[model samples]
Target: MNEPMDMEAVLERLKEKGLRLTPQRVEVITLLYQLSHPTAEQVYSLMSKKFPYVSQTTVYSTLKMLKDLGLVNELTYGDRSSHFELTQEEHAHFNCKSCGEIYDVDVKDAHQLQYMLHAEQGYQVDFVRLEFYGTCPACAAGGKSEADAGRTKQ
Candidate 1:
């Protein structure tokens, strides 16, 4: 897989788009690029550790701005909070029902799927999101699902 984009280039792109390079923006960008998939609250929590003065509202606004700029993608997993990630690459995601973790998986047949859809239905698609829901190997082996563990403790 290709390496994720460096934060420097991202910041430069943001600046090129007339957005100020504020410290809060930097923190949010770093979190979105570093953390696999984080929600606004998670980004704010991490930013608070580094910049205690940062607020959740700031993080939300920054994330919204980034999304508007097409620099990030907002993903929804069931009823959980929305997760944000850099839009540097096109890939599929595997949602682990057991642990609620999202793992990236290669979409080896994306092009084929697109072709099939167009040829079959005479449609043109811009982008596709293919997500699989199942238990990850770790959870299937010996790991207890989060809900199961919580219930046992109760």
Candidate 2:
């Protein structure tokens, strides 16, 4: 499981980036801190409950800014819409086909693989993304098969 995000650090980073600490931006960031693998629309929907006037554009722009700042990551799996998560230590992702849930997974020797690729293949690795797709524990317990991987959220 991922640790809770440090809101103070996020605010400090925003200040360092010379960005204003607007209410909308704060709400969006707070949502990112709380949600795991939420899409842009999901963020907007939750934020709208508090600030009913909040626009989807605001969510998208805030997410884009955070992505540009390397504070968040957007993931797209199978045929689902993109999901957002806070940038953290190197890790992989597991997508549950039956429930459409995204889970964080620890990757072993991830850095070694990057180093090996750089030393042996002459490739300068920027970052690595490893994703696994299959039925989750609950799905498996329910006797769901990999063919049910077609289930996905927009």
Candidate 3:
């Protein structure tokens, strides 16, 4: 899943999972593969432009199905709506505190930590999802929003 999947690859995955294919579902999978990280609403919005009668339920259900099948991962940060991305190699995520942008961060140290815990504590390693919060370069270099203007370092 690290590599971007073509339409046939996506369809084959759905078929392997015993899921029926429909035009709307195919569109949803296409968006999931194309968009960097999208919420259910964003998927619905884009699909609506093409399929005017598509329902939010359809979008949510499809996302749920993808997640259940392990083809996609859902990232939940605080109270915000979860974001979806194709399943990929383990990596960390950075959340820009000011603008709420999420970026993928390659962290070799994460693997080292997992190895250490497994070797020393006899704990089995599953998966790692580390979230770091900070101001992105754009927001930190004197590009603060009006609301952020009132905040200060303690």
Number of the top TM-score candidate: 1
Model 2's number of clashes is 0
Report, for every candidate in turn, its global Cα lDDT versus the true structure.
Answer: 0.78, 0.82, 0.79
lDDT of 1 at 41: 78
Write the candidate numbers in order of decreasing TM-score.
1, 2, 3
lDDT of 3 by residue, 58-137 (tens): 99999999888878899987697798877778888877778666666787798898998999999998887888899877
lDDT of 2 by residue, 1-154 (tens): 4553588988899999899999999999888877767889888988899999999998999999999988888887656789888888878888886777787878787779999999999999998998888878868798655444332332
Tens digit of per-residue lDDT, candidate 1, span 1-154:
4445777878888989998999889979977766767778778877899998988889999999988988889997668679887876777888778876677788788778989999999999888888888987868896756544212111
lDDT pick, better of 2 and 3: 2
Candidate 1 structure lDDT? 0.78
Q: Model 1 compared with the native: what TM-score?
A: 0.86
TM-score of each: 0.86, 0.82, 0.81
Superposition TM-score, candidate 2 onto the true structure: 0.82
In the predicted model 2, the residue pairs found to clash are none
Number of the top lDDT candidate? 2
